[model samples]
Target: MSGDAPISTPWRPSKKDARYTGPRACVKCHAEESATQHLTAMGRALEPVATSEILRAHPRLTFRSGPYAHEIVRRGDQSLYTVTDGVNTISEPILYTFGQGKAGQTYIFRHDGSFYESRLSFYKDIQGLDVTIGYPREIPPSLEVAAGRRISMDEARNCFSCHGTGAAYGNQLQLDRLVPGVTCEACHGPGAEHVAAMEAKQFKDKRIFNPGKMSADDLSQEFCGSCHRSAEQVISNKLLRGLITVRFQPYRMFTSRAHDPADMRLTCTACHNPHENPSADEAFYDPKCFACHRSFASLKSPAVAKTEEKEGRTDKACPVAQSLCVSCHMPKVEFPGSHFKFTDHRIRIAKAGEQFPN
Candidate 1:
């Protein structure tokens, strides 16, 4: 499960060879999975400004920091992002809304033929706007800077490649041919070949990449980590030393002492159903913990003993408690200034007043 051979997938959006057939093509066979997955956060990750429910619900949202003022207002079918310094002002029609607004939504717009990420983002907890995460906190020198942070060509390509399907092609972002949100083709690779194979009953070689076939370690560190930030990505990017890194689940989980690379049960997909939103019910995860932590004697079954013997390892049940194990060990930590709390993936006894592990 740890050092298995790499499983290749043709899901790279940057390459023109990947032909995406959209999620609609998948509904003919996988009706249920297609239906539920489309309702997940990843399904609605990116949407056009005109169809944003958050903006439609709240016609106007505003925030002020230092001498700058930011506002996002809905007029007709368009949402306008405006920023001002009293003397000078800049405004633009938001082109896209990133995120489904479960936690928050950020806007992206074009000004002077350049892409810019909105300076202010809508936080659901606050029910208004605030400075977008990772932006400078100080006052901007000009109205253009106050309006939004201009993104580079590479940044734009990267953002769209992850948020939307078929948005990237050969080192560039092809926004004109973009498909909003992470559709079925996004993870499963191009479905045109798979669909045709299935239609013709050619089961031998379906020609679709199944990420489920990947090993536990490869799935966590390579497949999902390609977007979610693997340990290698965090370390290389010099982001290994902050509360902000808590948002990167793969990196935090990789750093955990409890992380056994050979255990498939410890992988992300083992606990989280990637096709749906993560379950908030703590009880849902107890079985995942019990798969390893239950005492062999307590099991009173031969099957349990056989499994533990085969795995070459056994873990004792928690001496302290049995239920809601994550409440203490995997506590949720609030990201500074983001107005959101993310569950820390580092599985350990979280002692109060203790410094965050390096």
Candidate 2:
């Protein structure tokens, strides 16, 4: 869909055309993939919820920081937030939710032609509200504005660009016509030409951008890094490097010793399919790791692969356990306020009570 009209014209990617042909256009050709992708975090990353639904799920959503109290209440069709310190108060209607809400959901409101994230966010782990991810737990007493964090225009566009498909048209946010969540066009690029060619029964493939076909390093930087911070992005934003940003898989993966730009198996797609929810079973990832780590020079005893040899010495398996490579290597660490633990993607031997590798 383009604006208010159903796109029926033959697609032409000109300066005046609607380049993005929404996920609905891909349903007929990619029904199974489309159906499954909707369940992934990328698929439902952003959603516009009715105030009634928000109130029904979290009847008394609230959080307290210092002398102030932040509460979200539904009044009729609109959802409004009231922040108070027992003296002054500010109320604003929330317009959008920033996450799929599996881990957490931060509310956003529009005012003065821009968006602002709420002070408090709802985390599923606690099933209550807490300070939003990067914000400080306690607000300064001198600052009176309690409506929440106001996002800059660039920040607003960047947030929506990653969270929702077709939310931008060349850096200009089309917030009113956002497609809510990540969709086919988000990864595959605009589907207008692809759909047009397919519908016309053309035998040749009308090229649509596919990250899967790109080189491992290019894929990491362009596709995955479009949202997840890449090595270059992390390096550039040196001040932002810390435990909190380690959840960024691309940055961590590209920084790892295992990352080989020339090796196709080293990419994120080797272990993850964006269309499906990643399996939590750590053992399932062993095969992927072993593909490069395991020694296969044991024809006499094919069932038992030999240990890897290094510096004229053969290493032995851990006496305590065998499988689940991720158990010790990609240890789970919790972000300060997100209330959920994500596996450290740096892929290293982490020791107890020591600072983790960046």
Each prediction's total of clashing residue pairs, residues at least 3 apart in sequence or on different chains, is 0, 0
Task: Indicate the worst ten consecutive residues by lDDT in candidate 1.
Answer: 1-10
What clash count does candidate 2 reach? 0
**lDDT string, candidate 1, 1-358, tens digits:** 0011112346663466667788888888998778688778898888998788889999988888778888888899999888888887788899998886545688889999999988777888888887777778788777887787788887887787778777777776789878889888778877788888899999999898788888888889888887787788787776456887887899999999888776798899988888888999998888888777764344576676667656643676676776898888899888776888889999999999988775
How far out, in Å, is residue 328 in model 1? 1.0
The TM-scores of all predictions, comma-separated, are 0.91, 0.86
Instruction: Superpose all Cα atoms of candidate 2 onto the true structure and report the RMSD in Å to 1 decimal.
Output: 5.9
Please write out the lDDT profile of model 2 over residues 20-137, one tens digit for every residue.
7777778887888878897687887877667224455765677777788788876666677778888877777877777744457888887556677776777777777877777666
Q: Candidate 1 regions off by >4 Å?
A: 1-9, 295-313
